[model samples]
Target: MFTSPFQDYVIDAAQRTVLFWDVMRARGNQYVEHTAQDAPHVLSYDFEPVMAGTDLPSPVNYGLVRIEPPKGVKVDEAKRPFVIIDPRAGHGPGIGGFKADSEIGVAMNAGHPCYFVGFLPDPVPGQTIEDIMKAEVAFIEKVAELHPDASGKPTIVGNCQAGWAAMMLASYRPDLCGPIIVAGSPLSYWAGVHGKNPMRYTGGLLGGTWLTALTGDLGAGKFDGAWLVSNFEGMNPANTHWSKKYNVYKNVDTESERFLGFEKWWSGHILLNAEEMQWIVDNLFVGNRLPTAEVETTDGVRLDFRNIRSPIICFCSHGDDITPPQQALGWILDLYADVQDIRACGQTIVYAVHPSVGHLGIFVSGGVAKKEHREFASNIDLIDCLPPGLYEAVLTEKTEDTPDADLVATDYIARFETRTLEDIRALGTNSEEDERRFATAARVSDVNKGLYQTFAQPWVKTLITEEQADLMMKIHPARLEYTMFSDKNPVMGVVKSMAKIVRSNRKPVERDNPFLVAQEQMSDMIIRSLDNYRDMRDNAIEALFLSIYANPLLQATVGLSADEKPPRARPGRSPEHIELVKRKVEDLKARISHGGVREACIRAMIYIGQPDSAADERRFEFIRSLRKGVPGELEAFKLTVREQFFMLLIDESAAIAALPDLLKGHADEIEQGIAFVRQVASTGGEPSDAVKERLSEIEKVFNTALCTKR
Candidate 1:
């Protein structure tokens, strides 16, 4: 093939320039963490050594930093102590509290005492997850002891892997956890969108747990965590290859430091015990037994998620392909038959799903950290104040034009509605077919693990030594940047000197620069190319696996082996308990007939959704007008209504069966309530649609029961 002289010259120049750039970046990555890490004095970070009863338990260290809260945000004396646990999947600690308005910063600004859960770089000779759990409990207990006068319990904020870890701790050690908030944690691991969320199918496609064991063996008994973090990044080829790098290249003047900074942490992954990785994959990914009370600790202690007493708040986003809302909330469907089951378990689980925020947004986004995280920290008590049931989490943005929150130029109040088990299942739309596949994957993993250990174990143990293994962990392409760029290399000094020169000029592209605009467009184009390459690679792998696995006979067998089935209500339970429950339901039903919550809710819905042409456009005026005598009374009313509602749910099997007959008398009242809701809404359209839907569902249930009983 003949090439033009101009084209040949261009290709040669580009190759040389790319090679030089790689050399410089390889050196700069040693100390920077964010892609845009320009040194600013606004934040200071330190990972003070964690005191283990013995030598460093793991290669990880933990520490706390004092954040100087910016002006105007008040610190509340009565707030509970805040402890933020950043995910140690691939990155280093401190991102949870990386900025001044971060989770740690928000907690501190709110005047609550705060703590951080951190780790060292190396694990003890044989550190296990069980040991890590013991250390975290000890740390939290010490914080509680330090703050004897703090109101309520300590609020534990867990980000990503830390989020699931916190949930495990809360389930087993509820006394130690105050209120648990899991940000971007995927509990219902087996569930997700097939096309969009292909990551979860990894174990099945790889022929189960053999790869994990092989990788562990390859790493000489200690599994490299960089591999796992890479899997996370690999899930988003677009983000990892194109967007992330293009973001830095286009905004090179501002993004250079940030890119290096984030890469530093992302590349600085620690290792996990072979047992730890195996268990997480078997019990979490393939088996998905955690939420359904199937996980057992190493010591035979079963981990029952239902044991947790704290009001659980789940923060996830639709844009988070890694941990979609379906994956976050689907556990509810796996665990319970209905909303009543949640209440009966005495659990309050509230979930918030963002319209477009990504998984990391749950933790790293400044807007999220300031608003949702802040509101959660501030009103945790209010959430606890809610009756024992499921609810949605919402956050309303403050606007500039309106003195009142109604007129505030807010995008939308950030509020998440409490969802039902049915509501959760509705998101993923998974049927028995999907559940069976995960079950088969779990069984296959078991068989492969047993076979591998029997045939490959002796050889694997003797073939690789510690030194060879350690080098492999550091040099794994996933961590190539971190291992090569440290200051220990004399070559880094040259790169540092160049960086200093770049920092001196400190010129970013002007908002109006045409060249800058073109550069950004080009960067985006490169990013898209990378993303498409990734998409093609993933599709190819999936297609290959599908062709191998798609046998009607084999799939049927797998389905038969799946553990999912219908739930059974207990037989012949105590009559005394049943009788007492019946009476409470009756009393609560009467209370609701005269109360303000349903009425207030319906009216509020109408006023907000339907704008009235003739009337003043305010949602709470009707409720506010009724607020004169309710000043101290709103709390009293809320408590009374909440208590009665839950009480009815707790004791009303008989009432539930007879609901239609019961609703016969309240039919007029229910309609009146609906009509009142319609009047309060704006005139353009139906305002109280959700509330109406709720009422309609209730009516249908009653109508069905009435038909059968009569």
Candidate 2:
């Protein structure tokens, strides 16, 4: 107890040094072992391929596999199937089901049959983006055929890059799709703030798709995904170089497995054909044409997003720098004029925003799986039943006990709240001027692309060989870091032996050790330094982008209008289409008075809950329980209710006026319906003033109807 402070410090420092070396030795061995284990392909699911893309007419290396449910999880084929398409932006597939608490696991545990769309390490010769889309549509069709008795169409979940692919498929072939969940997918590429998101500016700063074409040519027509992975790592230098490794070193004993597991996925890079990569860059990333309906297939099919009829659910996070909420949400603003336009299009759009999860965490985090994914899986049918509108899916933790607590399955409640364009605009920090700058950048990109394709591409392709491309991929910085510490390195042999000895006689310093405290402080300083550099670099890039593209003279030189304005709507719709929509609207209005008690009740409920209503798990459970013995099947009844409710919402005043006729001489039924609605509204907690007012109006409608009947 009376020992000198210097003596304690010396002992702590020596112990930390020993632990640090041991961690390095262990990490070296792990790198070697993970590399060997995943030599061919790394997949988390135990699956059998139902349709291999390589065998299709237009062969690609991707495949559709059915994920075998783990023990204790029974899947009901009669329930809607779930198809999860993992993102293949840079890495190999299977992150969506890499663990038990994942998207696939969540769907399987909820008794739904699950399938996965995954790809191999190499892209097929001459494979294009259109080929991949065709393959995915085939997989979806196969799943639908297999689930003939299912209540509804299969629910497709697409992660990151796959999310946009799913959207394209839904737009092209809406009949074959169901409710689609797109998590961490960027539909609006150029819709980021000035200082916060700098990746959006990279396409502009680098000129454009010209670089993508150059990289592909340098790689002998096969684009290296390592470049994409490197870009992602560069976004967060603190995580890539400091925190990730530091966390493992600090908790080496307990974190070895988790660290190695993730590194395997992170390091498993895949390839894309030059054509595929160029199409993505030209049409999606640099061009920003997907949302505007300006992109078309080779066969002349206009891939308009408005063609999609299935409900769309977008999951994003505010903390996701790669696919920030602005990029994830901006497409809605681009595609629709206003809320009324969305309603007129008859599309139900819902989004959920996580407060602090990163892009990868949106698909792979266990905590996210247990909460958000769980709630989404449980409420798929409810989402399908929601009326055509823009809503935010809000998840709240349950705190107090309620009468229906036992009926609930999860600890959180999922609610839908109405949102508007203004709410979406608030997510970005850009003005009309910023948009004009982006437009100017797009114009510059077009010029650079034209010049490069005509002058540079032929020479670059002529000099590149298959061997040189392979060598370049091998020496990529992201890959070399792992290869340097592998067993093949002669220096790692000694490290392996020393690691074994250290494991045999392991000793750890106490948490309060003086030297350990100093070490943590040093680590924090290093991280902060890297973060500061990143911020400065991003700001500089933004400033340079503005200086080059935002100048009116430069914009005019590039053939852009000098006066800055928001993007104008592209003209493509036929006059016949407008006439058809008018006819449909008149037909919809004519059917406003034709419905039964179930329709009347559900319509009244939606009308009363219109302002903003939140529902807990208990509320959903109660609704399900009330429909136990109603009719042919629960889904059929729910579909009918949804159709009628949507019709009512279209013509609210007329629907309300006609409600008395629908429920004539049924006073007891009307009273029961109001009581049920009140009970459902009370499940979330005490109602807000708006909710109370809506409820009062609903009750007055029924009361007046009863009085008139009497």
Candidate 3:
């Protein structure tokens, strides 16, 4: 207390210096270790390759690998297998299962066989995106062959970039896919709102994908993924420059392992072939063609999202700036005219929107994996049972005292609430003006890309060399940051040596230490400043993009018609489609008088239940237990019930009129069915008056049928 301020200042400064040096040494060690481990490929999962894409006729660097189940977990070969495809945007594979609490882990824990679609660091020479898609199809076929006892096709989970890839595969070969979960995947490329998403404007502002071609050419036909990683980091400067490093420094002693482990995956950049990169940019990114069915494979077959027969589940987050809820959910609006159109196409689309979670967090966060993914994995059968329509999978936390809590294995309850196209629009930033602007951008991109390809590509390709390209990649700003502070740098050798001494004689600061508190305040100030700068820069970019692309003159110059509206819906169904739907409806009507008490009861319940409401896990568990007690073939009965329920939803009055035939003379079965319906309806709370009325009406129908039998 009696000490001079200068002495106190000197002591605090010395402690800070020691801590700083130690942090630098730890970072250097991490950098060196990560580099060594990442030189080949970085995958958190321990996997053995089942098949390599190179072994196929159309070779690719991709591979199919089965994930080894964690200790105490056993795979169920009879259960539907899960194939998780991680985003290969910039970082290496395994983010989908980087930890035990991840997508793959959740599937494995649920006793399902799991596989991963990962790629080598180097792209196969002369490989295209089409080849990769083919390889993925082959991988899925192999997995299917391996699990002959599996009840259904493999469930594929696609994260971010891989989400679109999986969709392509599903669209091309619908027979091979089952239920597909596309989380944080942007199908609608140009579908972001102003002020919130600046990345969408990047392609337009940079004048289309010509720059992409140029960059790839300069890289000796290999697009360096570090550039993509840099773009991601640029989106959050505070985290990139301050928070990420400060987190490790502040908790260096305990945080080293976790931080290093994550960085190993984050820093392991991959590569893409020039042709693959250009095709993605030209067809998907700037052109926005995937949802429109304009993208064609090398074999001239078109990719149509409507062709996918598997039930599609889209998992997105409102808080994800990279793939916002609009980008994730807008394709439904674009491809189908309305919810009725979805039903007519016989597609079951389920979507879940988390209130807050980043893009990566959607796939990798432990909390998400536990709640959303666990619920999804456990209730795949329930989802499969749902009628052909749009629905939202809602998850709510289960309280300790909640009814049937002991009977449920998970902590969250899962429910599927029927949703409408309007409900989906509510999740998006649906501005007609924004749509028109993006359409114009797409047109302009076509012009700019053609001009570049015709005039500039050949010259650029001729001047680039392998050695120069490798040097350029090595010196990329993102890679340099890591290399500059590693053992490769002589200046860091002293830091490593000094850090060992500091570690042995560590003098940790207290939480209330004045100097440490002040340091934190300074760090926060820096982060705030960086955030402010980022906001300003993003706003400016947005303003500049609109000023250039929204010009009427530019629209005319790009050959876009002046009075054209955005193409929001797919073209009307052809005559063949109309005839097919009519025939199917006729067939369903003919079969309406076909089943017994179980079918009639399930159909009537689906008819009367409120579409706005959802059933909890307890309800699903009760159903499962009820199924076990029933006297019929379980799987076949379930399928019949689902099909009958779907027919009822399509034509309520016709389906209800035929119910008497279905339940004729089965008085005891009718009573049992009513009790089961009541149990399901009353799981969350008391049944509504509407439900009670519906139950009464169903009872009256059964009574009438019994009297007729008499």
lDDT at 199, model 3:
88
TM-score between model 1 and native? 0.74
Candidates sorted by lDDT, descending order? Answer: 2, 3, 1
C-alpha lDDT (0 to 100) for residue 315 of candidate 1: 90
TM-score of each: 0.74, 0.92, 0.94
In model 3, the Cα lDDT at residue 82 comes to 96
Global lDDT of model 3: 0.81
- Error (Å) of candidate 2 at residue 269 is 1.0
Superposed by TM-score, candidate 1 places the C-alpha of residue 666 at a distance from the truth, in angstroms, of: 29
| C-alpha-based local distance difference test score of model 1 | 0.63
- Model 2 stretches astray by more than 4 angstroms: 1-42, 567-574, 613-617, 629-639, 664-710
Return the TM-score for candidate 2, rounded to 2 decimals. Answer: 0.92
Per-residue CA lDDT of model 1 for 466-504, tens digit only, reads 899988875677766544655556776766565565556
Highest TM-score scorer: 3
- Residue 599 lDDT in model 3? 83
True-structure Cα RMSD, model 2: 3.0
